[model samples]
Target: MLRIRPRALPVPATVLAWPVAVGSLALAVAALVLHASTVGGLRDTTNLHLADLWLSVLGPTVGAAVVARDRRTGLVLLGTAPIAVGAVAGAYAVWSAEVGGAPGAAAAAWLATWTWVPFFLPALLLPVVLRSGAAARLGAPVAGVLVLIAVFSAFAPGPAGPFAAVPNPLGLAWAPWLGPAAGVLIGLTAVVLVPAAALLAVVRWRRASGDDRWQLGLLAAGEAVFVAAHLSPVTAQPLSDVLVAVGLTALLGSVALGVHLRSVTAGLRRERELLATARETERLRLHRDLHDGVGPELAGLALQLGAVASRTGEPVLRELEGRLREVVGEVRRVVDDLRPAGLDASGLAGALRERARAFSAGDLTCAVEADVPDGLPPAVEVAAFRIAAEALTNAARHAGASTCTVRLGTEPGSLLVEVADDGSGIRADAGPGVGLASMRRRAEELGGTLRVGAGPGGGTVVRAVLPVPR
Candidate 1:
């Protein structure tokens, strides 16, 4: 089994992040203030911009920086900020032509024409990146798609409302295909991208547990709000942007809480791994000390006592010698219990063969067919060997079996172990026994599975598939 090291993510410095956060907030606030002062403070325009741009764009940007587990995550959260802010501030420039920032307002107006893409696209992506593992990796590509949508919309032939009044400085009137392509992208967003993201969120939510589950739920709700505001004709009403802001706030809060929760979960997992390692190391130390030091010492003392007893003809020394021999036997048992070495030194195949031999005696015979290569990871080897051993033990002890077979093999990314005995089969309704539960735990800990049932030939069979690290 091979361990693949995680690729290190690029982390932006505090200095760089601070500038972006400040600049984004400044632009959003300036737009809101300009819109408010020019259009009346009591009007819908000012209030709508306040809820939409501030929360959807600026709010998540700042929240991610402050609460994200990594700066890279914050970067992802803020990646689409410029586009969203541009669309808002640009619209302000177009509306209030005398608003002083009109010299560059054309581009913002062109951006404003497509109301939904800039803000809603990012919202659609929140759930994917927030999941924080393989999903977090999706942040870049999705952000790339967002960029493409924005860039292509610049040349969209029949631009949205704002584009007709104000020329797109970047618009290409000759490129008719660009409009259709952008439309296709939008179509894809509606048909494929949006549905996929939603499906991914649903799947993750179903699989998630505890706090993570609810965090995803909040995220899903937030995403839904943006989609609602974008698609609905009532988007011009203050309520739309207000709900959008509330949704963005939910998104921001859920992201922070999810990152913190996942971090806690990761920390707890590491602690558990450390504890297991410590316990294993201590057991090995105890095993070695007892086997090498105490066992021989007790045996030597017993021999000396026996000699003394014979030389002096003393019954007391003889009894003491016998007691020492018994103590040595108990020590050997303790040493054996302290550690398992068969699968540790050599590979699982050999260990399993030896185990089968040990269990093969009297009325029963055991056979092994193993196709495993050497140097399987200790965890995989241990799990496979232990499961096979337990299954064989159960068969030999419980089942009146004449013969048993042990099979060890590998499937694409997993190690397979199967033990079958031709004896009275297990009851269909029988619940898991202590041994079965233990085997299941061992397999599950490695993200694997175990199944016990009637063998194809007769009697019972136990099968476990343990994932081998690759």
Candidate 2:
């Protein structure tokens, strides 16, 4: 399989992340302070105070969490918008409420006009949640339009009672033209932009999988609550405030939880990969120990037995010598069974050729065609050699074959080994034996496949493909 590397974050940007996060968090805390002060200290019973505080806290917390994990600039900016805007607006509102001069009047008017800004938080994040460049492209213009509406509504000459159901502190009046224009713009945004964003989110949710699907579903639920509260009659009072709190909480909580879950899944996958690597290393170490240490000792003992047999010619001694020779052969076979020693000396192609030569005997003509490259990974080489050995053994011992062919080759990203025997094919009622299963397991462990069936030449064919690790 081809592997694509992700782009790395630049060094300076990564180093600066913590400072930016702290700054954003500080701004969110400042917003909370202003909210508490304006609502008559910490003892305020108003629902607006509670809603504003919830938003102020949730904004920075969710932003920091997303930035720390994903490090996507777009998402980070979206996540922090609520905290920044709320901080500025809350500070202005608190100053306006405390002082009663000209500056205070202007600040109060601005606060009353732009009270809807906090409600725009989810809409601002719609682009990020939708995960589409086109949505992001369109979001910029839609956001600009919303801003224009806010500016017009704030300065418009009309008797203002409240903005977005929150009581207006400054009974400021607006111009006739400004009020109608702002009202028309707000209506257009609600009619066009909101549905567009919702449709985009739905489409993205349908296309997403795994954790993304869950995240989007939770986000949708939160958005539904937010919208329902905003569209409800003005008499809903505390109910609307409660809905806003629940919706914002659900949105931020879902994002944080999604990020946490994705991180956990990635960590578990890495652990599994590390364990597999350790097992492969240990298997290769045992192979080397047996081949280097035990094989030589057995060979030396065989030679000593040969020398003793030449000097002593008794019948019993000769029989014992014969048995000793058989034992030596069995030891050599056991060493080979533990690991293919030929793989160390030669690569996969050379090792397969050696196995093919060993299998060729009376009534069996084995031909090997190998075109594999050097420097394949050790695991791939071992799996290919073992699979070829097993297939060749089955062909020679079980199949009444006249001729056999072993071919080794490479594709773009994998090594292929095929052992085909021209003999009576496998019986229909025969069960798959351990040797065939072992071959299949080896191939699968290496992220490849092995197929056993009738060959094109009317014989049993066993083909194994092992991926070449990048």
Which numbered prediction scores highest in lDDT against the true structure? Answer: 1
TM-score top scorer = 1
- How many residue pairs clash in model 2? 6
Clash totals, every prediction:
0, 6
The local lDDT score (0 to 100) that residue 99 gets in candidate 2 is 42
- Candidate 1, poorest ten consecutive residues by summed lDDT: 40-49
lDDT of 1 by residue, 1-470 (tens): 99999999776555566666666667666666656566533233322354556654564465456434645446555564564466455556545554454465665666564543555444556667665657877766776776687677766665443334455556677876777787787777755776577667767787775446776776666556555544556656566666656656665666666666667766775565455446656776788899889999999999999999999999999999999999999999897666555655556787778888888876889999989877676566666878998988988898989899999888898888999999998977777799999998877666677888887788998988877656
lDDT at 238, model 2 = 62
Supply candidate 2's per-residue lDDT for 343.
83
Q: Candidate 1 — which residues are off by over 4 angstroms? A: 1-15, 40-51, 54-75, 99-102, 107-118, 121-123, 126-148, 157-165, 176-192, 204-236, 341-348, 359-388, 391-433, 436-470
Instruction: Give the CA lDDT, 0 to 100, for residue 401 in model 2.
Output: 91
Q: Compared with the true structure, what per-residue lDDT tens digits does model 2 show for residues 54-168?
A: 6655655565556656554225434444445544454555445454342543454345465545445454455353434444576567668867877776666543313222334
The clash number for model 1 is 0
Listed per candidate, the RMSD to the true structure in angstroms reads 7.0, 10.6
